[model samples]
Target: HATHCPKPFYSSMKTQLVSAIHLQEVELDDIEGGNDPADDKKDPTYTVEEAVETIGFGRFHVLLFVIMGSANIVEAMEIMLLAVVSPEIRCEWRLEDWQVALVSTMVFLGFMLCGALSGYVADRYGRWKVVVAGFFWSAYFSFLTSYAPSYGWFIFLRSLVGCGVAGVSQGFVLKTEFIPARHRAYLLPLATIFWMLGSMLIIVLGMTVVPTYGWRWMIRLSVTPSVVLLFLFWFIPESARYNVSAGNTRAAMETLEWIARMNHATMPPGRLVESAQTERGSWRILLSPAFRRTSLLLWYTWFVASFSYYGSVLSSSELLEKNLLCITDADAEHRVKHRHEEGSVCYCIPFAFSDYQTLLISCLGEVALVPLNICLLNVVGRKLSLALLQFLSAIFFLLVNICTTMLGFTVLLFLLRALVSMNFNVVYIYTAEVYPTVARSLGMGFCTSFSRIGGMIAPFIAQVLMSRSVMYAMCPFAVASIVCALGNFLLPIETKGRALLVRLCPR
Candidate 1:
């Protein structure tokens, strides 16, 4: 090139060489500084689990907690409403003990029937869609229940309401997917507070509204939360983990971006690494060799938790009735005769003011034990903590047999409720953690459906048998709790401090 030897050519050659040298120096500086221009052009990538962990806990999580917790409150209120309104419905409709129990049985029957189906739908469609539909369905039926002219209509409508409640757990799944693993240990357990609040709220309304305007108005008022939830449903985003599993990478990224914005955090610079698509909501995965034992054990634990918890709630009125009879010996004979004639009537009114107060106090147990549960979840882990709670619950149920005074009975009952509530809390957290996102809702639904089987059978013991013999009814609860405790010890996996799986690894 120098051989050209024209002045213009030489000048051009000099400029070209100088520019090349400057560029080389700039690149060398960049290399020494460990900055790569290539990296600047290339985006970072992360899995859903990594993204969730990186996002950490923040304001968005708090808002999600409130919204999802409110959903829990509504579900609890609907479920607790059955216990509060059962006696009234029985007396008003002139129904037998079995018939009264049948109402609760039907509600759970519907819940059991729909749980798995809703999970499938949520997994295949979207969690937000199923949740919004569920709230609307439940709200509609609940309003209809207040207008039911006959017992038949009432049970039918309430059963449909139960169907709606089954879908509500998807919201919990949605919440679980968003929450970081560390926060889940406590936050999930804290959700029980809202459930306790709902239970107490219904009891309060039973005391105030039922005695005055009657059960109809109580039903009307109880639907308010669901209605309010319908309006706020807009705030909840579809789960990003779900999006990735469903092959919607773009949607997943958008959700993460929105979360980062809300939390005032930065998104990881790279795109999401789309997870391998799974057979959405496949029951086979739950029963595969890897998960079979855990699934079976979890199903049973759920059953026992629901059985013992609902049995205690439903039997409270009868227990209080008997305790009151013991205290006020003056009306014992008349009340005994009345109960005998009416076939285990707990209250002439749905619940007395004092009865509601006692129930309310007992509900405080659920709230009081939450801290202990969180501590156990974090320390001993989900498996051991659950086993411990179940064992303690069994002991408490046995102690109820020995209670001679109202104070003793109340204390035992409160402790029993606390243990069972904690058991349920653990079961919920454990189940949510154990399953991969691809099948989380379905797994939850399956376990929940099994739990409802216990729920369906509970009314018979709590409403009918407890009315006759306290020991007879409590024995089953104690036995179930013991069995559940043993099952918890056998659980194959412990989810404490582990990241939730986005999808199961291929065999």
Candidate 2:
């Protein structure tokens, strides 16, 4: 065969052999000179944080904010729906004050029970999994709640709905992981607009739908947002930080590449460096010496934020109800004289049109404060901003007790809602920033569960106590807010302009 080959072919073979020998000698010399071929082939590596920072905030984040913010809206509607429906539920069931209050309490009871568990699962399994499951769980149960034939079934289903909402918060954790640190202050507070919209939407439904179709139809309609969120779930990628922390470097890289493409940006020019995997959902780490003080103080702050915020929200209807009922001088005097009488006929009317209007107006307070909250977050920072909001909220809670005119009460309530909502926004941003990726979801879950404990107690004070005296209802919230303010001031670390921790300790 070699003899039959063309002379040019033989010449080419000889040239390739000589070139190969020369290349081998050069490579050997390079090896002997302590240069590595593998090193030459390797690209520089970047940490997940560095890659995310380079990707920066853009189109993907706005889409993420909307998707995750919609989850907040759904949760807000579910929670605010309780206050809107409680009056109707009370009238229909002929329930006592405490029983109606129990309806609200049970939802938070379920939330508190499942919040930490959901966090643990999100940390161990995946945030995207938990968030999607939560939406389905909540939507299914909320739909079933409209068909509840009796009080027992209604409360039971509502509690399960709360359980689902607990998991939905992982969406926020997921959103936080992706946001660039510089933009978090601006974007996180703005997310509260969705929550405010949800709150106002339920009130609008209460006014228009409940009067025309009744509360059942109102509930059926409330599930629409959750259903919509399920459709958008496809676009939400799992957190790249989480993927890196879980040691799934390829998945992390793929997600980052997708983010870069979506943002019209470029990823860092290297492989993603996987973080050392840590315990996925360790409660002990939160209580460890490093995070112990911050965790405890944060838990208390969460409790106060929920207690005061929900207390004001639930109490607003009752206060409005009283104002509506007492418009006539004779009726006002009669109510005061017979307020303590046993077996007295109770008026269990649903909120009037004007009452719903008032609620809607109050809901806007959160929106109006967004700009101010952003300023506080950026300028005053997390700790001082939180403390300032809480302190102002306490003052408003107290002012609500002293106000004599309905207009004055409404104004104070509006300001109070604005402050409490801002307080929640700050705490959420702070918590998401402070925890390491290894336990971010779990930490939020634990803190949220503590907040639910406050929610569990709020209805009693807001409904049962407000039914007796304004001071009784408002006093507890005022006290709690003051304590939370002090706790916020004492928080050990401020996360402003700080990078999120990947792990508590190097392994």
**Candidate number of the best TM-score:** 2
Candidate 2: residue 487 lDDT (0-100): 77
Candidate 2 lDDT tens digits, 1-507: 779889999999989999999999988988776465676467487898899899999899989988899998999999999889987887888888788889989999989998999999998889999999999999999999999999999999999999999999888899999998898889999999999999998988888898789999999999998988899999999988888878888898899999999999998886666665768889988998889999999999999999988998988877765442223233332244313358574656566676787798899898888999999888888999988898999889887877355556567778989999999989999999998888899999999999999999998998888877877778899888888888777787888898888888412
Candidate 1 lDDT trough over 10 residues, lowest sum: 325-334
Q: Model 2, stretches more than 4 Å misplaced? A: 1-42, 324-343, 505-507
Task: Please state the error at residue 125 of candidate 1 in Å.
Answer: 0.9
| lDDT on C-alpha atoms for all candidate structures | 0.85, 0.86
Tens-place lDDT digits, model 1, residues 113-222: 99999998988888999999999999999999999999999999999999999998778899999998889988999999899989999998888898789999999999
Once fitted onto the true fold, the runs of candidate 1 whose alpha carbons sit more than 4 angstroms away are: 1-43, 321-349
**Predictions: Cα RMSD each:** 5.5, 5.7
